[model samples]
Target: METTIYHYALCVSLTLMLFFSYRFFFGRLPDSELYRPYRQSRRLMGVALLELSANYMVHFFITPRAVCPTIAILMNLCTYWLSVWLFGSAMMLLLDREWVSRRRFVRHIVGWVAYCLITLVLWFLLPSRVSLTALPIVLAIVFMAYAVRVARKVFLTFRRTIRRLDDYYSDDGAAYIRWMSVFTYWAVFFGAGQGVFTFVPDRYVFVWIISAIPFYTYLYESYSNYLLLYEKATDILDKSNDADAADEEQQTAQNPSQSVADNVNCELNARPQLVMSHDQEVALERGIKEWIDKEGYTVGGLNIADVARATTTNRTYLSAYINTHYQMTFREWVNMLRLDYAKRLMRDNPELPVAEVARQAGYLSLSYFTKTFKDAEGVTPGKWCR
Candidate 1:
């Protein structure tokens, strides 16, 4: 009895902490499309939290193992399913594109929640033998089917979103997407823990609730950090979809001569796929090389737009030119340039602080620099310098 009381107390405390932390930190973000989804996310999360608190409170009144074992297990299982369903639905809205209406999408989510609630309530009110035997079978079928669908959606959507973020920007967009990926896997792990509660002894419930604190705290942190840059992410999503092929026409590039007779050897098959002239390519190649020679990649927060301005071209041309000539995305090209430069800087100025080395190498985040360096060279920057 005391263990159960303690478990609910911890749950309420954890939920309140997660609930208030986001509001305190990101409460002032002005309303926008991305924020609307995040707000909807928060709303559904609030409902889940309320359900958790209430369900835990109910455990104080009746022990599932002792009396009406079927209804009790039904109650516990329903609470777990509601939490997962609500949270999954929240993530769906949070990752939405502007191509759809948020208001309508949210209505659909809430309606789904209502449907799940009704189904679970019906199961709870069923006879004991049926609830015991049928619930597990039904849940197993539903879980298997739902898991497959979720795997496909996450793979496709995340691949597109991450690809678009990579193709468009050289910032935290993919980082945000990667964190969401982690949270999704974490949700799977969290949901799986419920199986233990459904089948095992009750004392282990405390262990699962303890795990919930950090797992959902990460969820809250990622959502808040995402809101910090959700506009950039949403901009990329709004402009493209997974099914759409990239347009070859240069929308942002300055008007350049279309004469293809100049004969520049970029050697990319995708070269002919674009509208760029040979002369324009020649000028861009020369200008981009000069920019690199001048250490333009060393600029803090360097992005494709900055490179576009420096080369007197535009983003579309710069991106395509890099993709064609270098055979890497702009971010990869810049990172390679910066990493090579940082190694040279380390060789020449071994006394430089690792942080200074990272700063001079165009990495705004030292941790990001260290990780990238280690991933590339098999050693930390400092260790590599030594």
Candidate 2:
């Protein structure tokens, strides 16, 4: 009866988390921001669902079983994967920041290495026996150590970022870091308290009940973050609408010369040049062409955030803009540009090797470029070059 209740609670918490995760990446995106995090989030969601399913099955139905090796292995794999996901998220957040530096990257690498080492040790130490008793003991110690390290780094980074924030910002969601910290603590606690039932079973049940509280809290916090982001989007749209109206009125009242300026601004603010209402993707394509021809910029070794910064925008905003304008995500947009450039360059330089052409056309990964080009152009770079 008690185990069933715990399973129910876990399921509810995971379900809520999944819902909010979807809402965060999909539901709230404007046309401009649709492709970036949304694309990545979709991939992450698959991983997350697998992880959650494995975790639940092992913890509920097969906690002491040796028969279900599949679920057991999945649980072990997912434990590592969860940490990787968290680390990746933190890296993405930091990479998105304007102030990301070499030192920060170094620290991030160090933190990731430490996490990997700890996870490997834990995996080795994990008992071959299927009882919850030995497993939790190992999990608790390992999680506590890893959680402590992560907590220190995350809190320090969060504090630094918060201090750099403006005194009054329309959008402030730094509070999520606090909730994440609490969740980390709870994860460690739950794993640590797994064996306490031997001494006092009822007390252990209460500990589980306490642990469920934080899981619920974490899930709710995720939902709240998504809600806040959605609200912020609505506010921006409202403000933009008001500004558009005010501009129209001023344009109506203006003389001919001033009206020309208004017209230019209007064109700039018009629906992004695409089939859809507005698209960031089209704008990115146009921007890439302009940079190559006019400014001599290169996309080699470039990530999405780098492209965003080059365009004087945030990645989310730029991603939405590209999606709205060109109907493609940053990844698609970048590959398209690279492949296009490679084709033109290869045609112009017939003597050049396909790999050289790819490199010259700003592709960091030759194999990746070849694969993407084949998908897009229906021919391999080498074959095309030939």
Candidate 3:
């Protein structure tokens, strides 16, 4: 009797989370900010949660059938498949790209996922003991192969996204990579727990679902916050792949741009390999110095795109030049300038409050400024002030 009540409680809680969390990413985005990859991720997560709720309903609420050996295995398989297919794949988009195409994303990840699912589904129809026995071996291989897949997909996306963030704005979502890393490790633990509980006694399954409610809540909140903060950068991340992104994307990487990149494969550090000629490079460098001398970096939320116009270059060329010349990302370069000026302010105006110093240095967030200052100088601004 108590067990039945407990099962009911668990199902109700999971259902509630599924219902309320919809608004996290599904709220109306502006027409201009309706980024495809971001929307795709939100849709994938919504589907994943729906799948999770269904599996949990059977696994927890319908405990008698759930405990049957075949049902238990099937339920676990469903959970595992959803984890890798929908949620994992959602997080893996736009990797290795200043911009990417939809076909490239499908080729990079969805193809392999489809292959694995096909193999698993086909092997399941055979009731042979050999097929059953070999299932664990196949899963081990899948896990190993998918490890490489995740590295290629998720890690590359992180690298490109964070670098792009660094190339553009200091206060954007570069720091969210750390949160994503945490979420990923937690996901592995949660997925493993779901599998393990299928074999354990039934009541403990509640623990995974109960904990999962909060986990999904955190995931939704973090991702939504990232979308809000870095709306512009995320919008442009997949612009080359989106059809509706005006006429330029129609003449996109698939034709001229992709061909140029593939043929050259040139060292990114080599300036001569760039499309820009010697005089253009000299003029751009001079223009950059003039912008710096004018204290353009002191503006709040200054980004590489803003300076790109000043220097008469696109952000691609501007980012490349900053990376090669300063040997740092645009964010790092900008922060260095900001910090040098901040140090001078602290030294000269020792009586000034830390918040005043941060604001004068063009830092909008005091905590972020303090963290950045501490990271670079091994001391907080307050200590540096003293």
Candidate 4:
């Protein structure tokens, strides 16, 4: 009875903490075509859900003998580490294209193999030697510190990228931001899991209770990700369906089998023109294109001030012009220019390699170019070029 009560209270507390964590630090989804990545990333959410559900089954349904709880704990720890490493690899591959560079990818794979070998050796050598000792506690602290470092870097990088997008790109930026948060939460929660066991000492039940925090965290986040993804997808589907219905209505008004694109154009013609400014903004747009097309200056070296100087405008005005005229932030506008140029190069000069085209198009790094291109074009540079 006492054990049951203790477990119940622990579960309650853990649930409350998770609820607040999400409330305070959760990410929002975007409301536009940019949410396509978020829709695609539902695969990750599905995998995570499966893993979390499996964990619960192991803990609750398969109650092993208490005679070897220590061994069971060690096995659990090793398996958890393996799972974390795998999940981290997936995130690095999906979130950051550069992570899969030839050298880094090989190194990561080798490192995982080594970790597995070491884990196997340790299991045979000291299978049940794990204890609530000073060493474990110290290691836990180190792991937590590593987690903090990783989390800081991930959060800052994500924030900077998102901030570079203007209002038009905010939806896509929001989706990436959500993904970053999900990955960051995974890192911090698991890293902190080691610390929980350290402090809980010989109280096996308490160790399990503390460990449940990360489990719950993963479960809730994965569930939320799936829900948001489905919601966004459904919203898009409904809008597309409404557009089809309107097109059908127009077709009926005219001749049967009239095209939807024609009806869309008809409807679009009725919309009011967006007001334009006759200021430094229009000049800046012309300057950016002229400089890129004529001078062949690479985008990596170009900044707001540089473009402003080329257009004989101030940085503030150039930035505002990009936002107002192009419906893009400075970074988005630049990327759009580069992507457009890349597409042209690809289509015109099919003989050139994608990387060479990227270079010629003013992209600094082919990896970054590929990622940005895929983000914009919905396909790899090679595929799109083909």
On TM-score, the candidate that comes out on top is: 3
lDDT of 1 at 281: 84
Residue by residue across 248-338, what tens digits does model 4's lDDT show? 4644565444344445654664311222356544666677778666643454545454565676654444555566667767667777777
lDDT tens digits, residue span 1-386, model 3: 24664576667767765774476346665555346666666676777777677666765657644445444554455456545556566666423322335666466457556645765675677666745456544554555455445534565567656765676675644664556666666666665444454444455555544677777877777677767654545544444224123223322443577435633552342222235669878988999999889878888877676787787765666767888888998888988998998999989989989998888887888898899999999999998877
Error at 209, model 1, angstroms: 4.0
Ranked candidates, highest TM-score first: 3, 1, 4, 2
- Which run of 10 residues does model 4 get worst, by summed lDDT? 164-173
Error of 3 at 188 (Å): 3.9
Question: Which residues of candidate 2, in runs, are more than 4 Å off?
Answer: 14-28, 33-50, 65-139, 166-210, 213-386
Model 1 C-alpha RMSD vs. true structure (Å) is 6.9
Which portions of model 4 show Cα errors greater than 4 Å?
1-65, 68-73, 86-110, 123-153, 166-179, 182-187, 198-386
Against the hidden reference, what TM-scores do the models get?
0.70, 0.38, 0.72, 0.41
Question: In model 2, how large is the Cα lDDT of residue 225?
Answer: 62
Name the lDDT of candidate 1.
0.65
Worst 10 residues of 2 by lDDT: 164-173
* Full-model lDDT, candidate 2: 0.49
Taking every candidate in turn, the Cα RMSD to the unseen true structure, in Å, is 6.9, 19.8, 5.8, 19.8
**Candidate 1 residue lDDT tens string, 337-379:** 9999999999999999999999889888898899889989999
Rank by lDDT, highest first. 1, 3, 4, 2
